[model samples]
Target: MDTGRRAGEPLVRHTVSPHLTRLLIDAGTAAGLDRGQVMRLPGFDTLSVDPVRIPTATIMRTWEAVGGALMEVGGVARVMELWRPGTLGVWDYLFTAAGTLTDALRASGLHFAVIADPVDAIAVTRDGAGVTVSWDGPYRDHPSYPLIAEFVPSMFQTVASSGAGRPLTPVQVRLPHRAPLSHAALCELYGTRNVEFEAGAPSITFTEADAATPLPQSDPALAAILNDHARITVETARPVVSWLDRFHLALETAVGDGPPELARVAHRLAMGPRTLQRRLNEAGTSWREELERLRQRRVDQYLRETSLSVESIAARVGYSDPRALRRAIHRWYGHSPRTVRQNPD
Candidate 1:
């Protein structure tokens, strides 16, 4: 972590493609480190190739690992160079499937939540001048924003240029923080002469004409499918006010008070436990499953974001014993509580 910025303390749960972690390992290897060295980093032993859930602190710590390795072996620029088309998994297809640069930009801003949304996200907005992307977030004060500054804009431009099938060079690069690299270095990396520093929100602008250019890989059908999938992924993540949602909400509200083998939750909702069980069954879930899911979510938060001891967390989550909490956490995450806490989901 850079000493210049404040520590990262994110308060919300967000997720990104696990391919980013896999690619980080590859990046370290490409930087001339042996794979084993990268593997030794905490949580790498269990990193998988799906969207990985994360807290605010975890992402900064990850970059601390990546940034240091890259700086030691290949300078900070190589870290930015490591990003490619599929770095974001399903979200990456929006580029190849989009009809035009404008379309791709629109798709990225709209469906970005399915991939790289943190507690807060850098909003992507396009105007007559160009598209503006702000890197301000909970991580805004993070020391690693310097590295994040280079990696994000570089990858964003690569995606934009690749999707446009033309050089979508930024007219100006506006940064929210001080530039760690030289102005000449920034210009060469972005192919932009105007690299503004400590400007407002970190941003980049493309020419209006470049934004309108058509992409060579455009496939309207593929774009539709990808968009539909993104929509569904985001929608399901939200708590809809359906019947099952009401039951889940009740369980969530009652959990803090204390959970009792699926307590008066059903009764409070004006239904018998059996009737609620039947409704949940029809919804393809059960009372126990929903309760477990609720406990799992709370337990994960307590474990990741707090210094609360396992026993304390267990009691708060209504576990009678820490052993039961351990078993339940393993059931939900397929890993022990210690392992889960180390990975920070």
Candidate 2:
């Protein structure tokens, strides 16, 4: 049976893992932006960014911009810090539970919905002399896609080393796409071979001998904690959905030559300004913070993913003066808009 695909309640909303955030901050500083800028983001209370209403494409661009800076700053050590303890804890649990590397990956997929932004789906199947572990996902067309691709192989290596009780050599990798300049990125990130795009499916085939290893029994206390963590994390998804709905309505109304004020948004939601403020406060956020966060997310996405000039981007994001927008970008990312556009992370 495909235990990985069994239906269940959804996991938590996508969160920015603490480790990833640390890496991004370090990278930003390396790219000449102030490292503190990352902390200044209104909602970055913890390592996780709650209620991530922004599209995945925008998130990818932001990562690329910061990633380049991180690479320039500290290389792999800095990048490695992006893995959060909770995320690693989950990975550890899976590795200890599965009988083989392939089985471990399948377990990871089964639990991936617990993450804020799930990146890969894993499956295992039998072939003539071995087992194949297949990994697949929607690869958004972004420069950072290649960078993120490295996470899979790195993860596999980490598990293999832990299970083997020593460091392991890199294994061959199979990609689902043609080799792009970014393919070189996979080499640097994963230290594995990158096969050209294949139509059958993307997988890593290994001997069945690797599959016979038995996993340690799961610790009851740890399993309980993990289950609780997944539940609490999933609860955050509700707020994100509410935020998206509210933000979308606000954007639609603001586009009709209307003012972008809290009162305006409140009216559209059929509530008084005071009532809206109370509700937002009750939800543990505020109108100003939401507006700024949404704007920053959108601006970052536009700068990294599109060829739109600064002027056009500024206008689209509700800024009439491109210079002011540049300053805002600097405050948020600790670099000028031009720098971000020139070398995306």
List TM-score per model, in order.
0.59, 0.55
Worst 10 residues of 2 by lDDT: 6-15
- lDDT per residue, candidate 2, 117-188, as tens digits? 454466666656565565565543333444455444465555554654444444355654445544565555
Top lDDT hit: 1
Model 2 bad stretches (over 4 Å):
1-8, 11-33, 48-65, 71-78, 81-87, 118-120, 125-143, 169-171, 176-185, 197-207, 215-345
Q: Give the residue spans of candidate 1 off by over 4 A.
A: 1-12, 51-56, 72-76, 233-345
* Each prediction's whole-model lDDT (CA): 0.63, 0.54
Residue pairs in clash, model 1: none
Q: All candidates: CA RMSD in angstroms?
A: 12.6, 8.1
